[model samples]
Target: MPPETPPRIFAPDRRAAVRRRMLNLQQAPDAPRYLLDDMIEDVVERLAFLRHRPQRALLVGDIHGSLQAALEATGAQVTTVEPALGFQEEAPYPFSGFDLVASLGTLDTVNDLPGALIHCRQALEPGGLFIASFPAAGSLPVLRSVMLAADADRPAARIHPLVDVRAGAQLLQRTGFTDPVADARHLAVAFRSFGREIADLRAQGLTNVLADAGPPLGKAALERAIDAFSAASKDGRTVERFEILTLSGWRR
Candidate 1:
């Protein structure tokens, strides 16, 4: 029997559009970059701590260009594939033979995440390192509650589903990676209004890319959501939490 097809939960075109929007926004002086910066810092630290120096590196979905710069600074030749340039994570990579593969903030929306992970593993040379960081489960509790309140009797799918650390570890193991490791970290940001929080999500390409996302909320629902968000705030600001999951493994 043929292999089963992965469910089409995310829209590839929507993913590309959001990523392109993010790339455009990142060129502005006041773009929100905390999430990407935090992920990049963690990846760099992991590389340093592991003492694994890559002579050639492949970077996936690095919107800010900081990861490429850092890898180049380490004397590693970096090749970047960006969503803005029509790079699809679920598709087969055109090149291989890299000692390091670092994917940032893009894996969560792929429909065939396991296939994508397998592709990354296949692209690596023997003993190559693969590291990926993305928003994990348990993120955005405040926003989730507000969205639910907005929908009232009918809760809409406003947020994309996320993978947890345990699932990430299992994926690495299933994809033929050795010494797989998975961990999570939380980052909290205070938002004075719901609009500001939405803006941050848009700037980071963290907005909903689900294929079946519900229509825009009506004005009354929007107002209710805003009010609910405000009601949950403390000190005139609502604190939203993001759980970032990082997965690392070595190609045996």
Candidate 2:
């Protein structure tokens, strides 16, 4: 079968923004990154259920380098793939004999989700495990609603494209993975204001990357969005739910 062509719906400017933010994150080192750290913790927690530790592992889009340390703590020789390393379409896919592979917060933004998943499975030896997580399907419902309200009768595309967990599982199975499993973990966060929520998104590389994203909200629209967001607040704090989905499978 021919490879599925990924849509060119994300822009280069978005990639540049992510690079700048990631660089800032590396410097802060000890700064608070709740969402990112949670994903890393979740991945580590899942590893506890495995009978044997992985001998060789791969970490894609290493977040704050915490995951690398965690993987190394288990004595697994781990290799990291950073986005700034620029492993674009033209580059050779590296799936070489890894016993375990994990990715965090990167698959959703990829140009070719299916191709990437396929390569991840191929890189692993038989019985090798793959665990990956991304902000999929039900992420940021409040923010999405606010953005749409900001545009009122003429909503513009302001959110990044998110993968549905069902489709992700299908891709894993289609790519010849065995025992594919996918599940969503919900994170409920309370923020004092919408601006704070936006800041969290920036820190997590969860901004609008859509090539079709329209212009920034004007002053009036911004006010409307703020009001709409505030209306959903409870006890002077807005509640937001972030649905992060974890995908797991084993190389057949």
Candidate 3:
């Protein structure tokens, strides 16, 4: 029988190893959740421009866990790239000029939304279409209220640094895309319990706001949060509202 070999230990430092482990603990699954599917479906319904077979299409979206929608939006022949979260890569521009490029609710979370749009425009053919959806800065007041009540001494959560519709249109125009326009899609639903709402957010990759002020939540804080949310609920359920802004332009 051959001699057994010991496992290799490659970590250079204990602190570095601990940091990596913590990152792994924070890492979440890259799959869509139940209600998030409905949210994406609703967005797809509004994307009427995706009816035909463009010579080439580029799909850009910040679907941390909503990869299903991203996969469905891009065609089988289409070359896709996500550039963030798990699948990070710059797309090889597939055509001399792409016929269309789209980012559905992804740009808002990016460090440079305008830069991404400019990159998309440069990749497209003249007269090519650019379509995107992003949550407006004005979304989810009800949830914000609950967060405020629970964490009174703490700063409010900025879940996503979303762009307003006007600014989003300006970004598209600034990228040298023409006839930029913006529209809104408001999603409203009621959850029976606050826990369900939080679960949905987790599944959607919407809960990882990095600015929590307190230490890891203790039992009392959690109970207070639940109570705050329950009291905020209207009638029998808490109303969850998401205001999404859809924008489009043409490469001129």
lDDT: which candidate is best?
1
Best by TM-score: 1
TM-score of each: 0.98, 0.92, 0.71
Clashing pairs in 2: 95-123
Point out the worst 10-residue segment of candidate 3 by lDDT: 6-15
Indicate the TM-score of model 3: 0.71
**How many residue pairs clash per model?**
0, 1, 1
- Tens digits of per-residue lDDT for model 1 on 97-180? 999999999899999999999999989999899999999999999999999999999999899899999999999999889999
lDDT of 1: 0.93
- Cα lDDT tens digits, model 3, 51-163, are 53455766654333353334355652344555333332123344447766766544554444555577777787887776676567777777677666666687454354567
Instruction: Show pairs that collide, candidate 1.
Output: none
lDDT of residue 27 for candidate 1: 87
